[model samples]
Target chain A: MNDARRHHDMGGLEAGAIDRGEHDKAPWEKRVDALMVLLGQRKILCVDELRRGIEELGADAYERYGYYERWMASMTNILLEKKIIEVGELGARMAEIESGRREALR
Target chain B: MSRHEHTGGPAHAHGHDGYDADPTHRHPPRPDLEDTPLAYHQVMQMAVVSLLVEKGVVSADDMRAQIERMDALTPARGARLVARAWVDGGFRERLLADSKAAAAELGIDLGPIPILVMENTPETHNLVVCTLCSCYPRFLLGLPPDWYKSRSYRSRAVREPRRVLAEFGTDLDPDSRIRVHDSTADMRYMILPMRPAGTEGMSEEALARLVTRDSLIGVAVPRAG
Candidate 1:
């Protein structure tokens, strides 16, 4: 197999039948979309940068994560690389939100 | 494996029957209502929004407004263009020549990327796909559907579009040619399907009602009402 194609370069392959059933979009997904739009609108990150981040996600994670999940990962990575949002602050915020969510559920 | 189940034999149960045609639906319940813990991405999304708003890079109000602007857009915008092209050949020529200006005439801003319009005639049908990730004409046709972003479609659209179209219940004539347009980040595409016969004398608004999102994607053709 002398294949040189990248993981996300699935232009033509033996992929199976398409799933026609449309799933209900989650609110989080819309927020992720809005985040991208805002980021783009502010000239903080371009769509090309997002595409590159997605391409860098390797085969397994690319296949595993949902569409917007991959988008979140890529955007976060780009923001981190750009120094727009530091990893420590982001992790701390996520942990705080997680605990608050757990408290509410409990 | 496959991402979604192949609910075959279709007039497109999910959307085209009413979605792209009518542009109205209910979204799923918010994740907060669910008893399970927040997903990793959901947490990240919240954190990202909070950080952006706190840092003044973008306001929460502006974020909401941006989403609303996108939410307000629908396939009707593209349908109106298709219907206008159906009734006027001059408009069609202008559309195929410069889609952005044509869409602008209709008060639709197609954004920075150039979205090319491919007209479908009796001899040829055009299909749109984004193999290298979903590079769709979002501002023109609203958000790309899940199936449009599916790995199966991304892979097969350029390879076996005829079979894929058949899955959408669009069986083309044996002699008719099918052209697949793979959209990139720099350029986007949408199919201007042939006007169904016997649609004469109908107002443009009435004709626009017949254009489905699937048809605009070249998987199906609008039917005469």
Candidate 2:
């Protein structure tokens, strides 16, 4: 895809440029930087694994992650093994929390 | 020829994906992508890895010598703060009042976006999304999941969270309410999951274990049993 198409496909760069007061950086790129930092910190597992987590994840981490399946799973597995996640448990709690959030919105 | 499994599930013959259609079993890598050099990216990666190691947050010798290819795997700094909140009510109050200060207390400095921590009370459920995309607080949490940024999740989460939750394998009862928050502007969130019952006086590590990454993200609940 061309730069314009790529930019559009990722998410609008126009909004990013306006928001940052500079050239727009794609959302996926920012996520990549965050993952690198996490790897550096030894807080997570491997780089590829982090990318996988980004793919499988359904919620925002620092900012957001674009669809990159293989990479996200790798990250999820490593983080899961590292005890950085509570896995099946956290999902259940988030549902309960959302209930209250819905009321506030109404 | 069509491959068939004894269990009755449709299957593929020969090198057709794995038994379960898992990619890990089939066509592992494309040669072209594998042959490409990543020297420059690796160098940049090393700089980040070194920074974290120097800080002593992660040991240098414990894991691999070099930081391999990276991705946003787990929830970032935000989860840590939520864990802290689970133990210390006073700190939790401070966090909800001023996320930046609370984060600083834990040595996490979130620049620009003055982080604001939100508590998920019994009456309100908070789900964050960047309607345009996914905007999370990585300063507290580590990274977001892949599904978070998908077109379906981003679009549906704000308008129809109950539906989204069900899709994510969280089936809530009809009587239970659901709320979703779109994370926009400078404000970012780290969910304060309700303290689980039991373990009235567990140690910090034990409690931290219960405070899973998903709970802080407002997706899952703490494990009580």
Candidate 3:
């Protein structure tokens, strides 16, 4: 056994009973899943790259974020790391959408 | 017959239609972001998608098509494969040898990822778990269930499988051995459960009805019609 196993690598450990409950995926989550596949198809980001990004998320974020949320975090980092999208560009886009949403609400 | 040839919808449609009585528990309510603000990652996703489309990295139509393709894939594809394997010995061999290739022969694109089909016999049962992250056979089975990605399932499935199976209401014979396959980075796994008895002489489509998603995951054996 590796002495320093990553937090996401939780194979054999004591845990609570399984939650058998299921939920229909939200539209946003589906979009996340689709974008992931699409990114792979475009050779922009590979599964391994996304996976490595996720593996590096420390124990705190790994447990806190939802599954697709973690994926979103990973892909966002990968895109930025590859210089596909810059930090300012991502921030500006997000702000534009947020203000647009707010305007629609008003 | 192509096993699942005639279908406007699945022969055995599952209920999560909000009408199903889940007396025990229900998924947490999703906040109406209209009244509130979207989560950070939700905003990030929107921004990313917009940027991608604007950059011409991928078109909006490509996203729609990919999402539709993913949703269209369910356990039915796996069910169809199991039915074909049951009726055709050669297919069974090919399926066991290389599931992605076998699926491709049936026009199912399992992407480029390699998937291994584990066959369940009289004396053996197989279970799959991705202890790291949920590396499911997403192309074949669609998105994995939430429980599969849960910390409890990931931690316990590799060590206490039979007990977990019991939680899923599956109790195999004590004599039969259980083999747990931890899905790694490269390969994914799906189980080929043994056919239920007295289902002889049935059409492939009819046989496919007996093969449920849980059966494909080796959680429960199918019931004969």
Best by DockQ: 1
Model 3 TM-score (2 dp): 0.87
- Give the poorly placed runs of model 3, Cα more than 4 Å off: A1-3, B1-36
Using TM-score as the measure, the top candidate is 1
Q: For residues B1-225, what per-residue lDDT tens digits would candidate 2 score against the true structure? A: 001011122223323211223445442212111122322222223333344355554555433332222222245455567778878889999989988888789886765566666677666666666664456766556455545555555555656666665554555657656666667555776777777778688776666767766666666667765
RMSD of each: 5.5, 18.0, 7.6
- The worst-scoring run of ten residues by lDDT in candidate 1 chain B lies at B4-13
Candidate 2 yields a Cα-based lDDT of 0.51
DockQ of every predicted complex: 0.59, 0.03, 0.54
Question: Please, what are the lDDT tens digits per residue for candidate 3 over residues B24-52?
Answer: 33653232243445677888999999998
Q: What is residue B177's positional error in candidate 2, in angstroms? A: 4.2
Ranking by TM-score: 1, 3, 2
What is the per-residue lDDT of model 1 for residues A1-106, given as tens digits with 9 covering 90 to 100?
5378899998889988888867555556777988998899889999899989988998988887888888999999999999999999999999999999899879
Worst 10 residues of 3 chain B by lDDT: B1-10
Cα lDDT tens digits, model 2, A13-101, are 22210110111112233433555455645544643345345544434422332233223444445544775554564344444444544
Q: How much is B169 displaced in model 3, in angstroms?
A: 0.5
- Model 1 per-residue lDDT tens digits across residues B3-95: 311211122223321233222444322223234566787889899889988999989899779878888878898999999998889889999
Higher-ranked by DockQ: 1 or 2:
1
